[model samples]
Target chain A: MNKGGAFFGVGYLLGLFVALVAFWLAMSGLMKPLLLSLGAVSVAITLFLAMRLDVVDKESAPYLRWPVFIGYWFWLMGEIIKANWRVIRACLRADLDINPALVKVKTRCKSDLAKTTFANSITLTPGTVTLSVEGDKLLVHALYEQDAEPGAFDDMDRRTAAAAEGAPA
Target chain B: MEIWEAFLANFHAWRPWAGALLCVLGAVLVVIGTVGVVRFPDFYTRMHAASVTDTSGATSLLLGMGLMSPDLVTVFKLAAIWVFLFLTGPTATHAIANAAHVAGMQPVTGARARGDVGEREGD
Candidate 1:
């Protein structure tokens, strides 16, 4: 569990700082020096609190493979679009043809971060929401029975597992 | 710089149309989802309808407004709002569903249309 700390000294803090700066800039969109320095103070205070809480670790911010995750995000966006189309059509139909069902799925993701990512991805897509997580099993509710089949989430499960297979740092 | 200026002018002309289209799409989605919530038979089922409003409806509406935004700050704020909703909405939904389940509210499945089989089992 403690495998990634050796590589986590400056690189980890630098990454967090950069993400904070980007978020600050995106939020403010102001180029003035006074406001910029104030934002810097806010980021610094946040980082200090996070450090004090011992949350500057891989478990809390396992985005070391963020590049891969971004690619996965684009693919997930396509999935969301497709799912939205299906849900939208169902919503518009006079006779709602949805066959809602709850199905339990088994996952290979071992750590908390991977499990959460998988669950959030499922919920983010339309037509499916993870109701609960129990060990390796996830209780998912689906709008369509066909989508609840065991094979339906194979691609998603595979990709999620791959994305979460990052080094333990 | 002349081509760039021309491109900006064209974009300005088209932005309103695009924004209107997105807002219309969002409104339709929200109305449909509300109808579904009213029409659905059971608690778990209604949640599915609510999620439709939560995800696509909210996203499109925000994107529409972001398009009409006067500055980058507004766009970023809109994005931040969407992100906040996206992160918290499902968790809230899950929490509610979990609470209902704990309170012994069962989902309406096909076989148990008369609602007899599940009541005894969940306890």
Candidate 2:
């Protein structure tokens, strides 16, 4: 995880605070004054600890680009549905016609967050699994060889880089 | 106008049936995934089969539960479960695959992965 540096601005802290508070409220669903005070205290303690730990950075709180992330998530979900259909068919086919292969895919993501987002998205899609990530190279196992062809992940990689690292789309 | 009015009036009545249908669909997907796991040739391929259950199957079930939920709190909880599952499922799968790779396990690939190879040598 990227720690505090030039990206560790007050905005990130505020964003984290807001997210934590919203999460707490939604999980608890309690508006009582006593419960509210306890929640506030916990949230304050967490924020203080985060500041002391020097982890309040853009990577930690990247909500500024939530719109892009949300859009990418919808696209990813569609990809997942499509991939699921393919895998489901492979699962049901009596012939076992799958041609599984291990392929190394190169990604253009610079930051750890972007790389991780790309890798996780690949793994989340049913047909492909990322075994390991070495620098810009990811060792991917595919249920079907075609799924892991050289340019297969290009679209997802570009979207991930753009969404998580603010790279040019 | 009448059709829209009927749909609006019966929206609540349809919720349970829709929720049940989604749940059944999810169960079927999970069962098919289980079948895939048993039939797939290699560890890597089995993981793919398992993921179908983890992703779409679980998603369908969770969406159904959310729709059937009596209160917003329950829906929120289900959403939280979904977010956490989405985050963790793939990570866990990757970890297992990485471990297998590190242990010198070779996945069957290419033409060899076709139906003839019944048992993996040193599983």
Q: Considering every candidate listed, which one attains the maximal DockQ?
A: 2
Docking class of 2: high
The DockQ score of candidate 1 comes to 0.38
True contacts kept of each: 0.31, 0.86
| Maximum-TM-score candidate | 2
Candidate 2's error at B5, in angstroms? 3.8
Measured against the true structure, the TM-scores of the candidates, in listed sequence, are: 0.83, 0.91
Extract clashing residue pairs from model 1. none
Interface RMSD of each: 2.7, 0.8
Per-residue lDDT over A1-169 for candidate 2, one digit per residue giving the tens place of the 0 to 100 score = 2445445577788778998999999989989999999999999999999988977877766767889999999999999999999999999987888999999999999998899899999999999999999999999999999998889999999999999988889
* Candidate 1 C-alpha RMSD relative to the actual structure: 4.4
Looking at candidate 1, what is the lDDT of residue A140? 86
